[model samples]
Target chain A: MLIGRPSDITASEITPATVFRKRRALIKAAGLGTMMAWSGLSLGEEPKTKIQDYSKSSYGQEEKLTSYRDITTYNNFYEFGTGKEQPAENVGQFKTTPWTVSIEGEVLKPRKLGIEELMKLAPLEERIYRMRCVEGWSMVIPWVGIPLSSLVKLAQPTGNAKFVELISAADPATMPGVRAPILDWPYVEALRLDEAMHSLTILAVGLYGEILPAQNGAPVRLVVPWKYGFKGGKSIVRIRFVEKMPQTTWMRAAPREYGFYANVNPTVDHPRWSQASERRIGGNVFSRRTPTLMFNGYADQVAQLYAGMDLRKHF
Target chain B: MAPTSIAWIKRGIFLLALGPLIRLFWLGFTDQLGANPVEFIEHSTGTWALVALLLSLAVTPLRLLFNMGWLVSLRRMLGLFMFFYACLHFLAYLWLDHWFDWAGIGADIIKHPYVLVGFLALILSIPLAVTSTDAMIRKLKRRWKTLHLLAYPVAILGVLHYLWLVKKDISQPLIYALILFILLLIRLYYRLKLRRV
Candidate 1:
């Protein structure tokens, strides 16, 4: 379930940011997991995430990365569990060392390739993007990955291929969260053919220059900066090209709340919460509730994708 | 009319009622209030409010079933505490979430049933808390008990508020609902017994 956002932080007497940082350093020295306790103080810990090694990059922006702790600890990976911390606590046991992703469906050449083989398909670059959650919280993340188009182009989609379905690997024993009837097991997400080939879409392998943490979809995950964060399928094991639009987990669970495009449209409010404003992670708890931007501040890059369509009804 | 023994028991109950507030402060001071501090505080206060309401409602049934007449002494404090925390929960919504966007909140009340029910539960509780004073209780006399009967419906609304709030996984709210059902059954059982006589 999507958790509630920052509430009543204005009057809160939380420790001052300077004092809180001193304690965080102490906690870190003591080898304690005080990340959640004072995560707000660490949001600005890594602000110099400007990557200099991009063979092919566009829309580069200077942004502050969420505290590594908050980014890693607060997750929505239900395959590990529903609670935000559950993924960080449980995903450590997940094996990403020997990872493989099979690219199949409506393609000239279908093949199963290891993680190493996939990484070599295109030049890797770092893209810092703003990820808005459907739950009214947002984050700025610097992702190390390559354009997903690099891989899709290699698979060689046939003329019939118009949509793409991504399946995240979920075994009952390994992903015990699936044992419970929370969401359909082996989480699935879809992208329109044009959307899949967009410059903004990529397959992420790491964050903050480090290999992706298990909780943050280690090995490989999809990053569509314009869409809500949930649309980014994590720990992907299968990529299939389909003719018709494919069904996604959140869209199937609550179609009214989630949509196929799942674009970060502030105008289309979610049934449960308004999407107009979002509290950025890592800022002082109260002063950070800023108005959410259309397509999460990426309208200039991707607005032409939906020129004349009604986002509200399709939302 | 209060005996020394009952007075001592009342003090114990009064202090016990302060436990949630004290615990919250301790957690806050120690920096232990998890990732979203405001949400954590909101949930904790809301949960305690519901628990207090259920406990206060249980007083009457326990008095008759176990012949423990002294339980009534604890009822007023428990009920007042429920109102206190309910106010905190609503404040969290207004201040933390909406930032005093009255027009926005008013629209929310119209669109979302959970917000409507929760707002109703909080509003209905105000009069009950104001009238809880011993002076008001004595002055109002027979009219007091009738007005206080509003507690039952208020409890029902609270349970419903919780039921609609969660998007999925209703386990936490289910326990509260079951207890409320049992309390209602006990009241009905007593009414039938009196009618038989």
Candidate 2:
């Protein structure tokens, strides 16, 4: 049996050509009107904020993308709620417009950029990346965003900067989950400076060629393909460059179960579940488990980022 | 109560116990099991098993509290339902979740504490399920009661399995834990009062 092979994904084809064409048309016609029509609709019929004019990247172009419906509904955005379906159901009232992200700490240029300014930092690219969750499920999603390196370079971080800490919005007025103390408030995640600047790392503003739904981290969120899904903090409010590794929310919650670098390692088992194999989300119940890959099948591109470090120790 | 009414009540409880399984099949056939159907099936079966097990444990305390001796007759049926759902839960995990990979299943049972506890609870319940028949109960009247004491441990193990399985949100499992605690406390209270008498 070929375990963790790229061919595991090849068995399924990408979303059909006609749907792709319709998506392209939708992207072309996206405007301020679509943004206004984004509220009070069920996830099945939710009008997505269609992203305009993003260049398609070479990453995972041949892979089958998870359906837009599944991607929008099945999420781990704990700010909205912890249940997979709760985020979509509870996100109707969340307001993402007029958003601002403060970029500071150890950077020569400290400034607060509005959501639009962040999107304009560099040309957005649609990169289909395989996302593996710590709960042993995986999905291939086409995310539209600027590379994290572009924004970090723009910030002009000083030599003292060693790590980047990303913080998610946690307003009790808007987010119901924040009322209960799940994992300390304002979900925080961090990455090493090198990892943040890697080409594979991006701040995703949209997915499936649509402006990100509130459930799927609308406006802007980090997307680190090789790491577990939680590494990507959603609906981010602040990006701070720090000299020391920031204590991430999950790490603080359970230091033994979650680690600083949540890289997708099949050999390393989670305390409660196996990390060796993942159920591809879009398939039916009969779909056989697909073996998880080393660095989630991007080993060649990202292996050098942690050459000498022990993944088992870090994970 | 009259025998016919008692029979009707048992029938009602029986159908009520089957509701979750019927709903599962209905959802499965209608293609509404959601994104991760294997997990959905596994979760549904496991939760039903826990619910039935807790209900079975509640029979005695409820009977005493309400002064209704007839509730004792329903205990076996509730217990059998618990076993039935537990079997389905294990089958789903073994077949749907792991696809009959014995090595993987075996390793999971041995490696994770939650899996091990769940497996142990299922294994221990087998004898209670088999000896539930009237003939077996009559043959070993005194021994039968001792053997059925396994239910307490099984309930404890089931709750532990759930408590350990959750990632961070212990809310669901904590509710189960609270229910189990209250039931056990009621039994303890009765035992102490009987000893004093």
Candidate 3:
């Protein structure tokens, strides 16, 4: 839906070249001998440069530079204001220093993990991905985070841990949008354990290699690429493992409108708009409209997981 | 007041009526509307259309309730503004969202209930707008009044379209529905009063 020429994003402070060079330097400085060992063994006949190529592809091409910093910071969380830039301006009042993620329900530990402790569990890696908003606009963002599986493993999910529900902080004093009943405060997002373990699911801490801007979920947020952006709840404060499927914020607001599996499939049209195609963020205005892929183009890795299930029914 | 002064005031009012449309165009050109400029344009114009419709509906009630005869003069202008915004809204959806894919858009209208209602509301507004001029109003007098009655149904359909569009959080839509219901009730009361008289 974004019309007119794209903004001159060339002035972006976080360039792809800088991120690539930094990643290579980080890999070398870490003395990741284990990574080298795995890289050599996993790729039998493939050249050593193949792994670099794979990383490059994931990082995104330098030519197109389709990736961008996730604009959740410029979010209309609505409690703050209706403007997209309001959250970034107003969310500074929120204090994330004393933040703690409450892990409970089906987890064995059932304790709170401080933000610093959580960060120490796994080294952060930047993953550049195309983020499509249901509103039809999109962004390519380089997010810094560890896989959700890493955090789930730290808590030690019990056999009963079937679903993971994430809850955002709900203090109206900070998140003014919480004052209104636009949605139940402390927004919640849930995913199945298998889906949580899918390497793509991340507990993001930063974007563009900088500490996350308060508007962009600040301390931590969920990043589920296969689903629409809303599935990735921002400003997260609590994470609970539950046996039964947890009630998500959007699903509770309108069950008919939002389904539990909010996957981005072009075939399944949103009741209001068709999902058949998406305008890539930084592509050519007229010729760049790309056909949206099923499972957000993660079909090769994730489609079989839902093998016999009816997508439309679930959707 | 002198005749020339009154004429100048009338011309000034006409330009004032053009304010929102000019602002919309300026915003579109400035790129201050956000990432999805087309969607922003569509939403802005659609919101303005709803506001104009509400304003137009208020005219009769204001005249009857407050005995303000001058309010009747503004009704046509408000209705025209609603039509103008509706045109921009439809154009944005057709050009940007559908990329002028007529077949796909036609299929969408048939398949999607929300799109169907939205398209129906838009189509119905066209006749009302076309018959809004003083000449057309006089030429088809009785038929013109009857055709403009379609605005009530179109407004209802417009609200329904909004309600169905949102995936979650019905608060905004519900507020609009409440306002529309009250506006319709006022009209119903006026109609009943006229019949009794």
Largest lDDT belongs to which candidate?
2
Evaluate residue A232 in candidate 3 and report its C-alpha lDDT on the 0 to 100 scale. 89
| Candidate 2 ranges with C-alpha deviation above 4 Å | A1-44
Tens digits of per-residue lDDT, candidate 2, B1-197, equal: 78888899999999999999999888778777888989998999899899989999999999878988888888999999999999999999999999999999989999999999999999999999999999999999899999999999999999999999988899999999999999999999999999999
Lowest-sum lDDT 10-residue window in model 2 chain B: B26-35
- What is the model-wide C-alpha lDDT for candidate 2? 0.89
Q: Please state what fraction of the native interface contacts candidate 1 reproduces.
A: 0.14
Candidate topping TM-score? 2
lDDT of 2 by residue, A159-219 (tens): 9999999999999989888988987989999999999999999999988778888888988
Worst 10 residues of 3 chain A by lDDT: A45-54
| Chain B TM (all candidates) | 0.94, 0.98, 0.88
Q: Which residue pairs overlap in candidate 1's backbone?
A: A8-B96
The lDDT of each candidate is: 0.81, 0.89, 0.73
> Of the candidates numbered 2 and 3, which has the greater TM-score value?
2
Question: Candidate 1 on A215-244: residue-level lDDT in tens?
Answer: 799789999999999999999999999999
Among incorrect, acceptable, medium and high, the docking class of model 3 is: incorrect
